[model samples]
Target: MINYDLYIDGKWMASTGSSRIEVEDPATRQVIGSVPRGTKEDVDKAVAAAKKAFPEWSRTSAKERGRILRKVGDLMEQRKTDFARVISLELGMPIRHVEKWHLKSSIREAVYFAHMAENFEYEYEAEGGWVRREPFGVIAGLTPWNYPMEQITMKLFPAIAAGNCVVLKPSQATPLCACMLANIFEDAGLPPGVFNIVTGAGGEVGNCLALHRDVDMLTFTGSTSAGKEVGALALSTVKKITLELGGKSPLIVLPDADFRAAAEEAVYSVFMNTGQTCCAYTRMLVPRKNKEEIESFLAEEAGRYKVGAPSDPDSDIGPLISKRAFERVKGYIEKGIEEGARMLVGEVPGEIKKGYYVKPVIFTDVTNDMTIAREEIFGPVLSVISYDTVEEAVEIANDTPYGLDSAVYGPAEEAYEVGCRIRAGGVHINGADAHITCPFGGYKESGLGREGGTFGFEEYLEVKSVFGK
Candidate 1:
């Protein structure tokens, strides 16, 4: 079992490691590792260190910072296998999926930010004076467990590349891989205090970092409710905040669309990561005339995502993150049944007694007003809601409090047109292949700011106009 201490400044110590939190493998319900339970004091020390390192680190030229960021990405790419193994072991993502999606995507994000850091427009002449974009000094990054490597790097790489120091608080359930990443940056010769890791419950460590006076900005990814609390705490000090929160995103299939392809892709979108994804397209909208056909297609595709231990290479899906998540998802399934939504396949018990596995569930006869259709059930449960017209489909799609992402399936012209009407940060035409070149975020309660590409790199900066300098 791996035991990790708090990473503060350039050192790893047990000063605030008096308590410990066990990391478990959801597939086997086994204890894989443990990390220090950081306290408010630990967060303070981390913030102080980041604050101390900010001036000098931010003063470094963008080219130098870009070089260091690129080195970090290179090291990550070299050791990606190691990262994939640890993350899969802890989070129950299939090894193959972790390797294919998590590792490569994170490496690309880092490298993308590396190039943007140097080539980004930091200063440009204006009518009266020149506008300068400066680093926010110190950043507090609070990340979730679903996409461990990507979430951490998305916040860390851009913040650091923009010359801001960071204090990261990763989900305690999946800290080993994050701990390994901090070591990777250290190995890349990141300056002391420029990057720090404190592992603990978000209520304590996360709240402390957000409310810290020295911390200049907060970037968070998690549930919408938790985001509200984080935003409120940071706003107390009027600190800069970027939040990527929850979603009940929709996938609309027009009457003329290929029913099989739409249903299959919708299954992948909701079932990927066992539906723990924040922007999962859980609500699938289809034409009322073809409801039966779509339901049949969904059932067939649902059987394809076999759930098993994370170590199995052929496994397409794994267990939920923990027993709590398993129960939560299971409860959502039961609620769907209670609300009169018909289940085409799967059950509330959801099979598999050993692991926290939740079998894929496809709900039909679902109305827009049903509880299952409205709430964000972070599980492999897809709610199929039928619409009479494309206009009503667009209306139903945008009815949610979230506008994170959506997918439209139809002919090129109609699909793109429907996508245009859908209110989301991103709208995939016919597939759900992850794209990094575009900005990713939400319109309303889904999130406050965008992440990905140049937009993400700019989130760490603060603009100032040098008057006639």
Candidate 2:
């Protein structure tokens, strides 16, 4: 197994304790790697380093910062294949998608943020006064395992480009990518201590980082329940915080759309990344008259997405991240049947003796109030809810506590108009392209702050107003 050490103050050192957390390959259930199980002591040291590095780093020229970040993107491009393979092994995503969705997106965002930093107006005149965007010191970032490589890159690129130091605590289940990234940053010539990493349980290292007095800002991406705990801890210090939490997002297939294409889009939204995506379109709202026809198309599309090992070139889907996650997805399927939702595409499997795999599930005749329709089931499961009217479809779409990502499949004019009514942060109309420069976050309980483009970059910055500057 590959063993790793905690990275603090530009050095990779063993933790204060001898404990290490083993990371398993979801496809094989074999221990593929291990990282030091960090303690509060480690968090303290990382935070101290970040806090010490913040002053000079914050004052460094944006041009210089952009150069380093741009170099990081260049190096990541060279190792794209290596990064994709590791993520496929650790997170159970198919190799075909890992390169396109995870690694390429990370590299693109890094480059995008680098250019943004170079041209960003840190200070602008506003109504007879000058407003400045200043970096917050010692940001504590916690990322989830679903998109291990991209998640940390999503936070780190902009946060560092904004001239803030960060102490990141990646999910212990998939941390090898984090280790790889730290090495890249070092190679990119980032100033010592401008970035740090501590890997361990959320309760230990994450908790310490959240409440650490030196941390001026907190950014987290995970489940809603865990986010609340972290947000609470950060609140104790009254630090600036951003939480990108759970989502039960929806995809509305309007009457005017092509049933075949819309059905395909719906399945892709959920089955992509094995449905571990926080912003996945779990709920599908279709017109009542076309429900059965659309259901048939959905099932057929899902059938094409076959499950196999991540190493297999043709595998469309792979295993879940862990046994616990596998069991959780199974539990949700059982619950869907109990709630009287009609099973269209999936069933609870009879014990498979090997990998943590589950058949993709789709439930029809679902109501907004059903547990299956409302909760965020982070698996390859979709809830198909039929609506009588366009207004009803919009209402059902907005019924959930989450308002993350969503989509509307219909004629151009109709879809755009309907998309505007949804409460979600993003609405994909007619298979719109999702670039790295869009503003991404959620409304309501799904999240607190944006994570891409101009708004996201501003999250790490504190606003200042200077009169007659």
Candidate 3:
């Protein structure tokens, strides 16, 4: 059992750690570990420590801060197995996929920010005077449970690299890995109170951080509804806020495209993280003539992802995060059928009696207006919507509350042209790779602000203009 207390002011406090929040392994639905259910008092302590540490930490030389940030990545590499095991145990992502899916990006994010800290210009001449970039004090980082490792690193490294102190409250379901990260920070020689962790219910820990007057900025990654609540809560303080929220992104296949290869690639893209990704291409828009062919290819490719436990090396797909997630995804599949979308591949029921498992679902003959096509179903479910023309394809793709991420698989000119017409924050042309350095965010109700590379690093900074020479 991995048991931990609130990490505040560089020490573990267990006086209020009696009330425990149990952590479960989704693969077995077993209580594998637990962490303290922190209260508002704990949040207060964490915020106070961060507030106290801000002045000195923010004033530290950029090079020195970069050195610390680099050390963090180095320590993570040294203890890579620990991070993989804890994150896999909590998130139910296959351990075999850890190094590739989670740890690589997490480590790279830390290192990327380390370089930014060392080389990024903190002050530069603009117009007639010099402009300065300064860190905001006491950043409150609230992360979701889906991609626990990378999400935490995404929020943490950038803010710290920009010289801001942080008080983080990770999803209650994934605190063990966050606690392990805290241990790594301590060994990396991060100064006392520069980084703090408070784990508990969002209403208590997360709400407290959002409401805390000391928190200068809030960065969150989760659902659109929850992002609204968090953004609204932080408005009272009028602090800086950035959110990376939900999406119902589309994959458009033009008439000239290689339908089979595109369909197969789309299968891997959508079901990569068991379809829990916020920016996954859930909707596949294909020409009506090629719809049936694409559907057959999608089903064939999806079958390649075999479901099993996280510990099973041969397993390509693991269980959903919890009982609630499993049931929610299961409901989406049934709802798709009820709403008149034909299920091409997938099952409906309690076949695997144990873990929170749902077979990958593929829906064809789906309309843009149908509930299955519009909503963000965070599971291994794909909806294929056939359009008559290229114009209609772009229209159907953009007809959604989300505009996070999309893809177009066709010839260079045609794909680029269609991708330009789609109103998404990002559009991948012909299966292009998503680099960690690129800016990532959304449009419309998806959320505000961008994350990754310089865009994300700058989110933690404040600009000041000086008039005199």
How many residue pairs clash in each candidate at the backbone level? 0, 0, 0
Off by over 4 Å in 2: none
State the lDDT of candidate 3 residue by residue for 213-234, as single tens digits. 9999999999999999989999
Q: Write the per-residue lDDT of candidate 1 for residues 180-252, one digit (tens) a residue.
A: 9888889888899999999999998999988999989999999999999999999999999999999998999
- Pick by lDDT: 2 or 3, better one: 2
Residue pairs in steric clash, candidate 3?
none
- Which window of 10 residues has the lowest lDDT sum in candidate 1? 345-354
Model 3 bad stretches (over 4 Å): 15-17
Candidate 1 lDDT for residue 365 = 91
Write one digit per residue (lDDT tens) for candidate 2, span 335-446. 9999999999878966756789998999998999999888888999999999999999999999989899899999999999999999999999877867777889999998
Q: State residue 422's C-alpha deviation in candidate 2, in Å.
A: 0.7
How large is the C-alpha RMSD of every model relative to the true structure? Answer: 1.3, 1.1, 1.2
Better model by lDDT, 1 or 2? 2
lDDT minimum window of 10 residues, candidate 2? 345-354
TM-score, cand. 2:
0.98
All models: lDDT? Answer: 0.90, 0.91, 0.89
